[model samples]
Target: MAQRLGALDLLILLPDPELGILRPAPGFRQTLPGGSTWTELLGRCAGGGEFRATIAYPDVQRLSPADVFITPDGAVLMLIGGQPRVRASELAGAAGLVLALLRSEAREDAASASARASGDVTRRATALASSLDRARADLAKNAAALRDALSDAARLNDELRLLNETLEQRVRNEIAERAKAEDALRQAQKMEAIGRLTGGVAHDFNNLLSPIIGSLDMLVRRGVGGEREQRLVDGALQSAERAKILVQRLLAFARRQPLQPGAVDLNQLVRDMAQLIASTMGATVEVRVELPDDLPPVTADANQLEMALLNLAVNARDAMPGGGMLKISAEPEQVIPGKSHRLRAGRYVRLSVSDTGVGMDEATLSRAIEPFFSTKGVGSGTGLGLSMVHGLALQQNGDLAITSREGAGTTVDLWLPVSGAPAGANDGPGNAAEPLRGSGTALLVDDEDLVRMCTAQMLMELGYRVEEANSAEAALRLLDAGLCPDLLVTDHIMPRMSGAQLARLLTSRIQDLPVLIVSGYAEADGVPAGIPRLCKPFRQAELAASIAALMPTTAIRRRKDVRQ
Candidate 1:
C-alpha cells in the first residue's frame, strides 16, 4: 500500500507519555537541518499540538484522518510523501485498516501477558523501571542542548547590536568633519576677497594722507600760528593722526602694511605695557599678568604686537561692561605636522588674553575675525581689532585661535614662531630728540604733486637743498644731466620704473649715493633686498632719522666732496 501511494516508507513514532514528547522508535533515523531533533522541529510546527493529541488518545474515535494516523497502543503512523498518487481519503482508509490490525495485535499481547501475569509480574516491573531511568537520562541531555543553543543566540544578538551602534557613531563623526572642512574653505575664500579690496583702497588712501599729515605735522612743530590758530591746527593735526591710525588698522587687516619684524622679549613687552593696560581697563576690572620669566622671545613687530595687545584688552573691557577679571599669559608650545590646519609644525609662543565675561555663541565666534563684523553699538568700535590681529599673525607665519562658550568666557591666543636670534637692543622705543640736520643735495621723487611738494618741504627744512622729481624716469633724467644728489629718496609703485628699480639702476651708475625707498604697502618683491625702506605718511622727524641712518654727517660730507 505504501508503494502504491508513492510515499516514503511508513514510520511508526511513539509518544513518550512521561515527557509529552515524540521519539521515533529504535532503528528509525530521521534528521533535520542544523542537526535539530524531530521533537524540536515538530514542537515548533503549527499543528504539532493536535498531532500529539492524536497519538496520546489512540483509543478514542478518530475525528479526521490525514497524512498521519494513530494505533491503539499510542503510536503515530506517518506517511511521508512528495506527492500522493492516490486520494487522501483512500490513504486514510488504508491507514485505518493498518491501525486496526495493530490494535488487534496489541490486544493479543495484552491477553497473553494477563495469562502469565502471576509468574512474570516481578520481571515486568523490573523491565519498566529500567526504561523509565533511560527516559530520564534522555530528557536531561535535551535540556542541556537547548540551553547552549539559547546562550549562543543571545551572544550573537549582543555583538550585532554593538556593531550597529559603533557604525552609527562613526558615520556621525564623518559628517561633522566634512562640515568643518567646508566652513574653513568658505572662510578662507571670503577673507581673500576682502583683503584684496581693502588693500587697494588703503594704498590710494595712504597716498592722499601723506601730504596732509606731513604738512600738518610741520605746521604744529614750527609754531606757525597764533594761540587760537595754533589750537585749530593742533585740532586738525590730532584728527589727522587719528585718521592715520584707522588707515593703519585697515592696512593691517589687509596684510599690506609693512612690518619691521625682529626678535622681541615677550616678558619685557608685557611688563612695560602693564600700566597702560591697567589704565585702559579702568578701576572696575581686575587685571592680572601671568608671564613666565623664562619665556622665549618671539619674532614679530614690536609696535604691532603692542597695538594687538591693546586692542584685545579694549575688547575684553567692553565684553565685561560690569567689570571682570582679565588675564594675560604666555607659554611655549610645540606643534607636529598634521596636528593643525592653519599652522606649520614648529616651535611657537602662545600669547593669550582671557576674560571672565559674557562670551560669544557658535554663530558669533565663527565670524569673529571677519573685517567690520562687530557686536559693539554704533560708533563704539571699528570692528577691525580681531581681523587685524589675525592678519598680523598670518603675515608673520603664525596663527590665531579662539575658544568661547555662550555664557562662560572667551580666550584668544596669538601663536607666533619662536625667534632663533636674541632680542635686539634697538627694539625699544626710539629717541624723542630732534632729528639730525644734513648739508647736501637730496633728491625727492613721487608721482603725486602734493606728496612730492610735502616731502620736498620736509627735506628743505632738514637743511638740505632739495631736488624734486615727479617720477622715477624724471629722477633718472636729473641724474643723467650732471645733477649728483648726495641722497636719493624715491616712492615705490610709480609708473614705468618703481623706486626700487630706479635705486638699483642709479646705484650701478653712481657710487656712495644713499637711497631710501618709501611706500605705503609691504611689497616684498617690489623692493630689492638690502635697500633701506621707509613707510609712507612719515613725519619730518621719521624722514630725517631714516636719512641720517643711511647717510651720517661724516658720510654726507664725504659724499658731497666726492661729487664736487
Candidate 2:
C-alpha cells in the first residue's frame, strides 16, 4: 500500500484526483499563500479539458499533492502519490482500483503511525535510562568523595591529638627542669654561705695562735739549753706547729688560702713522688704513674698538688687493706663555656688518680669532698684531705670530680686550667733560705694588742726601731703627724678600711715606701698584688726572712727622714 521514500518518510500508493478530473481539487476561487492554489488550477483544466497544473502551499508543508479518483459509489478518493503524463480519460476505469489502493494506503498509514509512536516511546525510554545511569554514577562519586573526606578528617584528628599530647609532655619536662635548676641554685648559695663562715672562724683562730707561736720561737732562739727546758720547749713548739697545720687545713677547705700559682710540670712532679707514694701506700700496694710527655703544664700550687696526691694514695691504701694498684695519670681536657659546672670553659690538664680497691657507696661519695666527712678510724685521719684538694682545685679556677661504685674502684679527677707556657722542672726548694737580720725604722700595724706586742718584740730583738699603730686609722694619724719609718708593716684584715687600703693611701703620701703585709688566711679581694705577704702563726725566723726580703725593695727611701 506504501513505498519507502527515505529513513523517516513514505510514499502512499494512489493516483492524483486532479489528474482524473483533468483539474485541480475544487476550492472557493482562492489562491495559496505562496501564489498558486487548487482553485486556479481547476479553472485552467475545467470541462474535462486535457491539462495539468502545479499548486504550491509553501506555509502548509503537510498539505501534500493529493491523487484523486471517483469510486463505484460516486465518492471521490484522495491520496498522496505522483503519476507522469496521464490523460484525464484514463482515470474513468481506474477509479475503483484507485479507491481500493487508497483504502490499502489508509490501513498502511495507520500501521506506520503505530510503529512511529512505538519508536518515539522507545527513544524516550532510552534517554531516561541513560539519565538514570549518569545520576547513579554521580551518586557513587559523591559517596566516594564523602568517604575520602571522612578519612582525611580522621587523620587530622589523630595528628592533633598526638600534637596536644606532645605539648603537654614538653610542658611537664620544662617545669621539672626549672624546679631542678632552682633547687641547685639554692644549694649552691647555702654552701657559699657556709664556706664564708668557716673561713672567718679559721682566720680568727690563726690570729689567736700567731702571738703564742711568735713568743715560743723567740724563747727557743734565746737559747734554752737545759735538757728539761729544751724538751718542754720542743714539745710546746711541736704542739703549736700541729695547731698551725690544723688551721691551714681549715683554710684550704674553705678555699681561702692564698696560693702561689706557677707553671708546674705535672708529669715530673708525679714521677718524683712515685717512690714516696709507693712506700707510704705500703709494700703490698703497687703504684703506677702514667705521665705522658705531651701533657701541658697546669697553673697551680705544686706543693698542694703533691699533698692531694698523697691524700688520695692514703685513701686508696686504706680501702684495700691488703693491697691494690694506684694508677696516676695526666692528660688534657676540653670544657665548654657556661655548660661546664663549677668551672670556666678552657683547656685543662686533668690529673687523675685511679685506685683498684673497695669503693665508696653513693651516700659516702656524695659527701666525699665535704670537710670532716671521713671513713677512717678515729686518730687515723683528719678528714680534711679530700676537702683540701677540692678547695685547692676551686682556688685555681678548676674543678674536682670523683666517680666510684660500691664494689668497683674509685677515680678522682683534678681538672686544672692549663698554663700557656710549657712545663718546667721547678722542683727542689730553691737554696735553703735562712733568717736574715736587718736594722731599720719599722712601722708595725695591728688591731690586736697581744699579736702586735709579740711581733714588735721580735722586731726589736732583731735590732730594728719599731713604731706601733693600733689601727689603720691611728696609723694614718701617725703619718699625718709626720712619723715616717723605713719600713711599713701592716696586718691585712683590720677594722674600717683594710691594711692594704691604708698602705695604698700611705704609699701615695710617701713615694717608694716599702709595705709588708701580715695575714692569717684572708681573701685577696682588697689586698693589692705584687706586695709581699707573711702568713700569721709565724716564727721570728720567718718574720725576719720576710722583712729582709722586703727591705731591698725601697725599705729606706730617705734614711735621714726616719722617726723611730
Candidate 3:
C-alpha cells in the first residue's frame, strides 16, 4: 500500500543507531539530519501492536464480503479472498518525529566533550611558559654578581701596587742616612786623637820653658860678661835641646813627621831595641827577645817604628809595678779571613810585646786605643802612649790588637805588610848619637813669645846669626826688609798665616831657601809638602841638627849675600 506518515509514524521505527557514537565534527557540519529514512515513518505511526483488515474487488460490482478491524492506538486489520485475514501497525509519521529528537541530542553531547578537552590543553601550555621565564631571571642575577666581584678585586690590586712603591723608597732613604752617620763618626775620632796629643805636648813644653826662662832671667840680670854667665847660658841651652827632642817624638807619634818608607826587618828592629829596652826598664823588669830567624822585613817608616817599639816597651815596664818579664818577639802571621781587623790581606810580620803584669778588663781594653783614655792616675800619665801606637799602625797600613784579662797579663800584637828583602843591622845607641851643630843666618818664627825666644837663643849658641819673629806677619815683614836668612824656621800652626803659606811666599822670593816648620799640633794639612818639620818644645841640639841638615855651610855661604 501506498502509505501516508503522521507524528505517530516516528514512534513505531527504531531510534537512529548512530546516536551513541560521538566524533570530532568537521569545520562546516556541526548539526545532523532530522528524519530521512522510511523506518522513521513506521515508528511515527505505531503506538501499540494491534491492527485491523480490509479488502476491495476491482472489476465486479456486487455486494463484497469484507471485514475491517481497528485497534484503540490506530492499528488496522485487513482480509483478502484466498488468505486468512492479516493484522499490521501503521506509524510512519510518529516514528519520523522520534528520530529527529534523538539526532539533536547526539550533536549536543559531541560539542560538550570538545569544549572540555580544549580547556585542558590551554592550562598545560601556560605552566610551561612560566617555568622558562624563571630560568632566564636566575641567569641575569648571577651575571651581575660576577661583575661586581671582578671590580672589587681590581681596586685591591691597585692599592697593593702603590704600597709596594712607598716601601722601596723608605728603604733607600734609610741606607743613605746610615752611610752619612758612619762618615761623621770617623772624622770625630780623628779630631779627638789630635786633641789628646796636643794636650800632652803642651804640658811638657811648659815645664821645660819654665826652667829656661828662669835661668835666662838670672843671667841677664847678672850681665853677659863673665865665664860664669856663659856657663849658665850653656846650661840653659842644654835644657832647650831636650825640649826640641820631645817635640820630634810628639810629631812622630802624630804621623805628621815626613815618613821615609822602606823595607825594615822586624826581627832586627827588636834585637836592636834590646839594650834600650833593658836600660829603660832598669833592674826591676827583665827583658827577653824572641826574634824568629825566618821573619820577613816589613815596609814602613824606620824611625817611626823605632819610636813605637820604645813607647810600647816603656808602657810594658809601667804596667809591671812589681818586677816582671817583658818579652818582645817577631813572627809571620796570616790574618783571619772575614774578620774586620783594619788590616789588608797579605804576608805580614807580627811584632808582639807581652808583659807579665796586671792586665785590663774588656771595658778598659776597648778604650785602650781611644785618646786620653788611661788607667793610670792623673799627673802620672799623659795617656797618649797607646793612642800614638794606634795612629802609627793605621798610618802605615797596618793594625794593632791587644789581648788581656784582669790581673793576668797583656799582649799587644802589631801586624805589618811583609817585604821581600832582609833587614840591615841598626847602629848602636852610642854610635848613632850626634851632638847638635849649625853655623848660618837663621830666621826663627813662632806664635808664642817663649818658643821664639828659646829657639833664637839656641841658634845663637850654635854659632848661627838668628832673627826672631812672634808671628808669620812679622817674619814676612823681616823678609821684605832685605833680611834674607839661610834658613826659615817657623811654627806650623799660627794665628794668621800658617808656616806652609809663609814658606810658599819665602820660597817664591828665594827659590833655594831652606824652610823648617815646628808645631805641637801634628796636622799636615797646613804644612808645606816638601819642607822639613821640627815639632815644638824642641831642644837646642835638635834645633841645631835640623838647621844644619837643611842649610849646610857650602850652600849657606853661596846664598848669604843674596838680599831680599
Candidate 4:
C-alpha cells in the first residue's frame, strides 16, 4: 500500500501533472480510524498530500499553508486543519458502510484522480494549439506590410523619372524659341535700315523736282508764244518733267540717289524753316525757334536738311490738331565717348524738333523708325517723313534720337558733325553767278530713254557735245573703243554693270577723268565719295550750274594735286 501511494506521488510530479492513476491499497480490508477503511483513507490522503507537497515544495522551497484533499467516492475536497471544506462527506458515507464504503470509495477516488489528471492534460494541449495559430496570423500580417512598402517605392521612382524627362524637354524647347526670336530681331533691323534709305532719297528728289516742274508749267502756260511747234515742245517738256519726278521718288525710296553734301548752319536752317512752319501750321500752332548763338555748322545737303525740319514741323502740326507749340532748336555739343555713339571726339551741332502733343509709348516708339509704320490714320500721312530725317542724319555722319512718353509728347534730336566755315561769304540763291558755257565732250548714260534724251538736250543747250548710252556695258564699250569724252556723266542703276563699276573702270584708264553721278537716289552703288551729284528732274540752269561748278578750275586743280 505504501509503495502504490509512493508511485502516485511520483506521477503527480511528472511534467504532465494530470496523467496519473489511483487504486485501492492491497491487504488492508478493515476500516481504520475516523470510520474509513485503511486503504481508502490512505488513497485519499496520499493523493491530496502529494498534490499539496508539490504546491508547497515548489522547486524554489516556499510553501503555501493550504491543504489539498480528495474525498473517497471520486469527490474533490479541501480541508482547513482536518475539517471538511467540501460537501463530499455525505456521498462518501452513502456509497458503503464503514469498511465496505471506505474500500469502494478508495477505488472511486483513484479513478477520479486519474480522470482529473487526463482532463487537465487535454486543457493544456488546447491552450498550446491556440498560441501556435495566433503566431502564424501575426507572421502573415508582417509579410503583407513589407510587400506594400516595396510596391509604393517602385511607383515613386517611376514618377520621378517621368518628371525629370518633362523638365529636360521644356529646357530644350525654351532654347530653340530664344534662337528664333533673335533671328527675327535681326531681320527686322535690316528692313528698318532699308526703309530709312528710301525716305532720304525721296525728300531730296522732291526739292529738285520743284524747280523743274515750275519752269515747265510756266513754259507750257506761255505756249512759247502760241505757235503749234512751240506748244508741242512745251507739252513734251512738261510731261517729261512730271515723269522724271515720279521716277526720282521711286529711286529715292530705294536708296539709289546721289547726294550733294555741303556746309549748312543748322541754327540758320531752323530759323528759315520756322517761318515756313508758322505760315503752314497757321496761327493756332505756335512756331518757336530757340537757336543757340554758338551753334556749329554741319556738312550736309542744305536743301534736304531744311526739308527734314519742315517735315518734322508738319508732323508736329498734325499731332496737335487742337493746336500746340512747335519748338525747333539748335545747340553745339561734344560727341559723348561711348560705344553707343560711333563718333570720335569732335564738335557736333544738335538740331532738335519737339512738340507738345499726344506722344508714343514703348511699342510704338520701337517701331517708329520703320518705313511706312505710322500711327496716323490711313490717307492722313504717308509715314515716310521721320524715316527721311533719320537717313539724312546718318548720311551726314550724325545720329538721331527720339524720346517720348504716352501723354507727355515727343522730341527728335539730330546730331551733325561740325565743319570748318567756307573761305568766303555764302552766295545766296539770287547772288549766285549765271551758268557757265561748257564745251566739254560729255558721255551721258541712263537706263530711262526719256531721262537720257532730256539730259542730252540739257547738255547740248549748255554748249557741250553730248553722247548718250542706255547702259553701263554700252558706255564701257564706247570708252574702250577709244571714245574718250572730256567727262563721264552716268545714271547710278543700269541693267548690266553699275555706274560705279564704269567709273572704276574709267578711273583706271584715265586717272584724272572726272565722273559726275546723276541719280534720283543718293545711296546707289558705285556713286564714289567726293564726286559731284545731281538729283533728277533738275532744270536746265541747275544742270548747267552743277557742270560748271564741277568744271576743273585752278583751285580744284591745286586741291587734286595736293590730295595726290
Model 1: residue 270 alpha-carbon error in angstroms: 0.9
Ranking by TM-score: 2, 1, 4, 3
**Tens-digit per-residue lDDT, 110-199, candidate 2:** 655665777665655454455446545654564456456656977999999999999999999999999999977886776677678878
Position 551, candidate 4: lDDT: 70
Residue-level lDDT tens digits of model 4 in 206-319: 544544554564465456655887767677776767556444434433444345566776667767566777998888988788887766677877777777788788888888
Segments of candidate 2 deviating more than 4 angstroms: 1-139, 223-232, 334-342, 422-439, 552-564
User: Best-fitting candidate, measured by TM-score?
Assistant: 2
Query: Which candidate would rank higher by lDDT, 3 or 4?
Result: 3
lDDT of 3: 0.63
The number of clashing residue pairs in each candidate reads 0, 5, 57, 8
lDDT of 1 by residue, 171-218 (tens): 999999999889888889988999999888888888888999899999
lDDT of each: 0.78, 0.73, 0.63, 0.62
lDDT (10s digit) by residue, model 3, range 383-438: 66776776677667888889999888899998888766555433222322343344
Query: Of the pair 2 and 4, which is ahead by lDDT?
Result: 2
Tally clashes: model 3.
Answer: 57
